[model samples]
Target: MPRIGVLIDNNTLDDHLAREHGLSLVILLDSGDRWLWDTGQSGIFFDNARAMGIDLAQLSGLALSHGHYDHTGGLDRLWRETDFTGPIYGHPAVMTGRYACSCCSPPRAIGLRTVNRQRLASQLIPVSDTARLGPGLTMVTNITRQAGNFEPIQGFYLDPLGRTTDTIPDDTALVLETGYGPVLILGCCHSGLENTCDHIAVNLGINRFHALIGGLHLKSAKPNHIEETLQTITRFGFSEVYAGHCTGTHAISSLSDALPGKIHPMGSGLLLTFPPSGHSTT
Candidate 1:
């Protein structure tokens, strides 16, 4: 069986849980593949890993879903503190400035501060399409929005002055080809969860996701958007979903109703397991 650990997120339930101001995940593949999905904004990678009992030296690789500070904030610490020597995966745009719209104007530069930028460059691999991180595990690099009704979540806007762009396409996910099915792990899914899954299906040349983990970015979804997402999930036939981080209570409830016990809430210290060939029994 493969093990997955939540290294960082927005909320921790107890001494056994950790909730911070950002999101990060540690993925353990059945093939002995290990990775740090996203790093939180605290930049306390060592402390967090020790607290969670995750040995940083054991990681096979490090991947960033995007360049957002919340997603890549620990880069400097990881590079400066740990002995981890691995390629960091993400789109090239991660190196560019990011911004959000404000007051109906072009937007403001919301990219990570200058110091962090230099550190990220030192560790970036900038993958495309699919990068096989290890046996049976591939990173889906491009996520597209095919549904017309699926709008980019609000509060995200690009600066027209050329200072910075949303550059969210840089956001990505991970796919593990376990015995049960392709276990999909995402960062923010800022590019849209459906889009990410669709890319995975096409890239891996298979349908039927065994597990869905990570942020769905449905915090401010509209009625139509929610309905569309529900319909899409039903059509896609995901067996299980563990969603959180920017996902609202209403959205979680809706997904729970649609997916029943298959729907679960993920937070810091929450541990999910999956047999090498099937869904996790416990």
Candidate 2:
């Protein structure tokens, strides 16, 4: 069986745990290979992990879905706190500068911090294509961008002035092979959920995805876009969908309504376990 623990997210399941606008998940494989996905926006992940009784020092490897600050902010603290000496998988462009400017607000840095960048250089394992983390665990990088309507969000830039549009090429997802099917672990899904799934199906030769657990990044999408996304997801025949973080309330509600019992609410402190070759048990 494989167990997934939500260490940090936008919401908390317990009153004692702290909530933040970020996401992080700890994956425990049946083979005893533990992997840490993303780190959230700050040291809050560490605090939440402590409350959840998770030991960071036991991690076998680390992987980042993207370079967004909200996803990589705790890297510095994690480096300082643990003696983990494992490869950190991510795209090469993850260390570049990135910003968000919206509604006349000044551009704010949204990419990984400079300090963490320097710290991670030695351990970082850049994944330009598909890379196997271990048995049944793979990192899918550079998702095919074929969805014409699934454009990148506006006001995001690689430059401070917001002149150059940031396409978020570093966006990636972790695919876990289970007995039921493949489970997708995403960060923000900036590459469009449909597009990401399509890449897994066509390029990676994965026919069906058993579950989708993580951010969808549909916060600012229009109603029609959400509907279209739901329609696309329906084709994947996923048995379970646990969404949080950048997936806004409206999008989650819409998906829940459309998918019925398949959509599960996700937050910090949530624990989900899946049998080696069967359905997941919450």
Residue 192 shift from truth in candidate 1, angstroms:
1.5
Q: What CA root-mean-square deviation does each model show from the true structure?
A: 3.7, 2.8
Residue range 201-223, candidate 1, lDDT tens digits:
67666567778878877878887
Cα lDDT over the full model 1: 0.72
Candidate 2: tens digits of C-alpha lDDT, residues 182-226: 888999998888888888888777767889899988888888879
Model 1 lowest lDDT segment of ten: 158-167
lDDT of each: 0.72, 0.86
User: Per-candidate TM vs. native?
Assistant: 0.87, 0.95
* Best lDDT among the predictions, by candidate number: 2
Name model 2 segments beyond 4 Å from true. Answer: 278-282
- Cα deviation of 69, candidate 1, in Å: 1.0
